[model samples]
Target chain A: MTGPLLPDLDRPKAFAAPWEAQAFALVVKLHERGLFEWPEFAARLSAEIHAHPDQPYYVSWHEAAVELLVDKGLMEAGAFLDQARAVVRFRASDHHHVARLTPIAVDPARAG
Target chain B: MAGQHDDHDHDDHSHGDHSHEGHDHDHFHRIHSEEVDALLMSIADIEISARVKALEELLTQKGLVDPSALDAVVDLYENQIGPKNGARVIARAWADPVYKAWLLADPNAAIADLGFAGAQGENMVALENTADVHNVVVCTLCSCYPWPVLGLPPVWYKSMPYRTRIVRDPRSVLAEFGTVLPDSTEIRVWDSNSEVRYLVVPRRPEGTEGLDEAALAALVSRDSMIGVTEALSPEPA
Candidate 1:
């Protein structure tokens, strides 16, 4: 409250997407569980943001979480990178193109 | 969970999109395959679920994180705590005139008396919406919100568009949210910071004069508490 004030922004909602919420929840839970302190997380997040200036804010947050997890030795760097790659591959090769189908009406008359 | 190696080169894409235009340091550059680039793009664009699931599994497997504990935290925000807590406070203020006076005079102590004091709500300020005055809350720098009373913020509240545009043009922003106030009604926006957070106590809607405190509390919406919209009028029972 005492620092230089930032311009007031319209806070329409808390989370823009599910990933943002997950990222937020992960950070808070990790802090609560003593994985890292809030200030540490904030510093990592600031560093992440500094590194990737153009990326969305939450993406930077996600990267910071990854970096902190790796730095703390709580998560393996190679394993995380591998998992991230695997997830990317899964989406690219198997999941991405699956078309969503609308539910078929049980009765023709019921179909609108 | 360590030894299996995929022949794919994961190290190539270590530097995804580091535009070092402002920085004057020479950083190592790694050559990336087109396939790896495409995969990274997909992960960044639309595969957040996959990435999140993978991260969660990795942490859980390492015994560093507990899934139930994470769920408990999310559930606490999503359910146990929320604007309903704020609604109760607002309803009490509306029901009791002396309490309303006290709330306006000293919101921090008033809110704590109602058992809604902790975390981001350590310093509280209640802005009352009257016939000619409306109050809205926003945090421009980061999403510093009243967690004790309002729970986790919605996605849009922390968005870049909202953060940049709200102060410059609040009426337009409120209009986008379908909140059209009269020109005669002066709009006041409260900027929330780490030290002080704000709660908008909307004017009680007309009708339902016989409604009890519980009923009044039930009518309070999260948007109304944020001052984006007004409380809903009573529906025919």
Candidate 2:
């Protein structure tokens, strides 16, 4: 018996994950704000595609935005990554996360 | 094991031994037993997602970014702009001969005239499919699609397989997409770049000459405008 004709697809959002949606929106928003040009993002994205051809399009696209942000000196590489680690920890441990909408305990680590 | 986080208002959905010390990360306090596994994203997706989320929160806190503006961008792409815009264009081209000629001659102005223009869609070239010829568009280097009309391209469209294969042997590629055309039809594959985006105006399906623009627009699927498939034929009378 066949499982189904077509692969199951999520109908709502284009990106694979919720973060991809935010990442996409952020890059477009940043470009609109003139922090960097579309071509600048495009160039980085093109290079990223070549660098990691196997990775998903948006994953590379997200990295391209991060690299561009760091390149333009608008964002610091170290702090940004550190915050990302903090966020991962926060999401996992914090009870008030999207998993539970109760008043969040800012995990002092992430708060600062 | 589940009693550690008794502080949270566990709504009595159900519970499991989901919260052990090492696995504290699965802090879905009140979630059902069945939902625990479903709620946990793949480790890779979770990592990248967390990183991007971190970037967004940090930027917002620094006042370097406006959360509302990000909201606006997501909302626009998610809802307002998509292939429906392109379908309308294709439908117009089919219904109005004058617009078809104008779209073929100058797509940017013709497309922008319909208010579907900006960003990746600023430079537009409308490729028309005819009885003797067929047109298909691809961005070989990356997923450079026409956003205003096509919206964000589908997952398969951006995949390496589709990008590489579509250009090499479009007939086989189109066949895989269930777009079988006659052997006599000349298939033209157009490579899209950042400079110029291509929107294929598929041949209108036979019958239903009486159908108005809105009805015709409804028949134009996203893939049809992309040239991967032909427009849907009107249902039996």
Candidate 3:
């Protein structure tokens, strides 16, 4: 129980992506702030993993934190859902902008 | 109701339920079950920063949590504490034969002597890597790492793929990380099943006779301490 559910020897990088580090920090910070206890968070995480076994672990942690906040009445359910939609929209646009990057073509007529 | 959305892929796992029509966010699909809802939202590819930011703002406004105090905690782990502490331990062991003997004999006490003992590191065993043998650490049940020395566990360490693959074929796993050992060398994989944590002390690289303990510590990489790689050799001046 103390160790992970699966055991592998592959040495992982400290942070595979930036968002992962953010997710990790967010949970640690929330735990330190007394928003929820470790056992409570772990239980919620377990429930989340049980519900959806394919999702990443930190994603489960993120979802569990949000669910805990809503269940505890700390966050308005409606508002949090709205925020999540808005975030998806924002990220989609951000991804689009990065994905469509192209070099600017110089116009000969405008060249000094 | 729980398994109803199981057929749907997680990316588009939203459900259309018109229960609270008066709220005016009709496009917002609400799943009443907390676990299912959270699972859906997590796989929806929602921006983590945005979600965490919104949560922090709401909690701060409601006086449920403090933003600055939360930042302080993040700053402590991300910056102030990490593998450097473990590097220092490795360097000391390399310099003093007596300390190395003590570290091999009793890791918990020796690690505490240097003031790096608490939480997940309460019980520990040091595995020394020699020319003929190498040691690597893994936690099959969960990511139970030696936090005091190595800092937070890496993302892949807690990942399901790593948890499942490393135990079965350690040589191939190490090879994926660009660590190819000699056929004569033996690979020992340590399963951190109980409270007892394991730390890999890599053999000191050659051609560093003139370097001091501090410099030697600088050569130690996080991967070396994890036993997947070896310390870097000293650079020519």
Candidate 4:
């Protein structure tokens, strides 16, 4: 039950939406394998934001949501790239309509 | 709703002893969500206010989430939403002749002189606004901002849509923010990098030659700093 928990639904603005949440959840699962705790994840995120005060909002689209999970050990860094590629590949075909919700496929090769 | 706006300057007296030792970092976070709600509510007269108002209502429901947990959320808003520290530097540049010279020579040094410290600020350059030219800043790669002077950024500024769209077509993006400028005005877009951040110091409005620095600073808005709009006339006495 303690496996990578998701952000509360009410805070959806913090993340883009459902797909974005899925991306984050995948990262959290990756971090769960690494054994990082939620508090640590929170602290590291705050530190990253604080460290770049002048560049206050310096997080890119992909890097902002999913990458933070990796940065905080909520996921592995390599896992993000691999899953991203797979996500793109899956979306490029008929899989988008067929799947009820595409489960994020973490690349085993990239799994840390 | 106005009560929330009035609470912005609230400070607990219990922390006077431990204020500066980094312990107070948490204190700022504690009240941040309420402050952000108030801030968004205060500025709800704008176009984006409806969306923010929806967010406030959805998130404020009892048992759905911790009310104070929004402190982090508000903290996030503060980072991306407003006339950042960089813009403040621009305002200083406009008003202070000495600082203007310093900003032109070495923006980083001039900014530091104002006592706002940060890593990215160490290598900054400011673009001064004029009647004919306007400067807008964006971090296409990420959401880099100047947080020293500007309290916090509005929620919409941090959205992916704003980030991706603004750099490619600043005029369109600015228009959405309620800025309507003449085509004759040249808009300069500054791409923020990891080491350097840029702020636009807008020219002072006319008929304000006698205003003090405090009064002038009050006229500077987050939109003006972002180059979406020019500073308007100060309130009549």
Candidate 5:
């Protein structure tokens, strides 16, 4: 934890919510995968601190997690860019399947 | 949990109102929530074992495609892809206004430009976040989403609670994600009952001023696309 600081759990319930749990999960997984050892994760946090010295000290843990993963090659850096291009190819007719269910028929004869 | 889905068992929870089996089973192929829950259990077993012994037997009996290949594809779709594409779309919308407009109007064309084509994401919409009003996307049933943009619904986003609550009480829902909006903020509740899922192109923060497009794009998080939160200020590296 070389980052400026960890998130404060005492601030509000939102800060301690489950959303952060998933973000933390990615951090733990990144660590387990050997993408960045403890020292490297600490170094990345340190770097973020040097860079954003003045910003509020909140949720940087999650940002550091994403940055460390991208920096350590665990996750694709172009993930967001790729998603933008993917959202453009929309079709009007596809809205019909929004509530569509798998077609599984039960014959009237099968009714008990 | 199966028979419970037939009726609103958790009415006090506010989310139990959206009934998945509201239709008459006579005209429908009704699979109760319990049945789906069992199917999910089987799927989990197959997924965890990697062997999928029952799947293999069924495939052998019904002459289905290579079971291994099918599982691999399912794994790729379920695990590998989804949120990444969503981030990409959000980044682009942040960078280009015209492109963002096009994305809002016709999301499929915008996404195709990035070489991602799919059945679920064909009719897409990009809902941009403003300071006053915010938008969050969710599927009321199972986790149907614009996976081509978003990689996958985060576990929290896919919860029965989130799906049912977000539509009725978006302000409160966003609060759980640490997003607080003033009473003036008009939350557009996009009922994604159809496959036209939505992504929130969060407004770029101020500290990131003068940063280039690439730098700005880096700050937009996956949760921002789902409209739970806004993008953070882009920190200098």
Candidate 6:
């Protein structure tokens, strides 16, 4: 948890979101599973924190996992982009969408 | 701990035009009087939270992203997104024979019918595991997975040994995953690619005959969907 902390901050920040906790857990789990060493993750996290000091802490955790995993070939660089773009597209294919009053009824015959 | 976000003013409730199933399920819940949001926006003075939120707002104002979509993405990854999406699909397939037929015939359509379609998951193929044969999914070239339903691949899924060894020795690999099929059953390994993503529909547990879709869905795990394990056995009656 130690990194370049904001001077005015008195206490350590807690995970504000589920993704934050997931990121933290992923790193720990990966380390436990021998995917990478704690020191490797620490170095990656330190570099990421130094790179984006103002960004949320867990963002660094997420990015460090990305960096480390991608470096290890455990995660392909393109796959990460595909995953992100897919999540975005899953929610919104475009910037705007019409609000609907009811759920779209599924037509069993055709639905793609 | 996340529920402790209760301090953010719950006043000025606005639910007029809001629809529960409007695709963007919790979108309009943000309209809790722009005043509170404005104050949250105004306070970049301190608190890591305000800064993170401001970044999201900045991205929204730039039109690079939709606020509702952004929240939906975060909300999804944080809570909703996971094998649950695929679990529902499997549950539906098991519950309705017609859906099973449709899913096996045209997986993308049947899966998208449940609202789980996106990039990296354009052409889905549902592999139904049965008594005669077992099915598993892997991406030997890279981590090509159905992100809308499975999120990202687990650590071992992306490991070099798993990527290479599974194809060469699937039985041993399955055994390593603690998934042992009968000697008489055939093991089939499906390699996932950029164009096509595979979701393994595990064999329905025996005692689940009377269970409804949700109850059945509860028994489905991420490993089961990936073919590393079977759906959880039903609770004793």
Write one digit per residue (lDDT tens) for candidate 3, span B11-130: 110112111011111122343334334544642443454455445555555766654555344445454335457888889899888999999998887888888754431367788998
On DockQ, the stronger of 2 and 3 is: 2
Model 2, position A47, has a per-residue lDDT of 82
Scored by lDDT, the top model is 2
- Compute the TM-score of each model's chain A versus the native chain A and list the values: 0.67, 0.71, 0.62, 0.39, 0.48, 0.69
Cα lDDT tens digits, model 5, B9-75, are 1111111223321221121134454433344342212111111122122222333334333323333
User: Which residue runs does candidate 1 get wrong by more than 4 Å?
Assistant: A1-74, A77-112, B1-83
| Candidate 6: regions farther than 4 A off | A1-112, B1-83
The best candidate in terms of DockQ: 2
TM-score-best of 1 and 6:
1
Model 6 C-alpha lDDT per residue in residues A59-99, reported as the tens digit of each score? 66666766777788765555444333222222222122332
Expressed as tens digits, the lDDT of each residue in B1-237 for candidate 1 is: 111111111111111222101010011112233555454543344244445656766776676667556555555556423445788888888899998998988988788889865452136778888877778876654555675677666556665588667766777788899888777677777766545667899999888689999999888888788887898789987
Say which prediction, candidate 3 or candidate 5, comes out ahead on lDDT. 3
Query: In candidate 1, residue B223 scores what lDDT?
Result: 78
Ten-residue region with minimum lDDT total, candidate 2 chain B = B6-15
Global CA lDDT computed for model 1: 0.60
TM-score of every model versus the real structure: 0.50, 0.50, 0.50, 0.46, 0.47, 0.49
For model 5, how big is the iRMS in angstroms? 20.1
Query: Cα deviation of A22 in candidate 4 (Å)?
Result: 21
lDDT of each: 0.60, 0.64, 0.58, 0.45, 0.48, 0.57
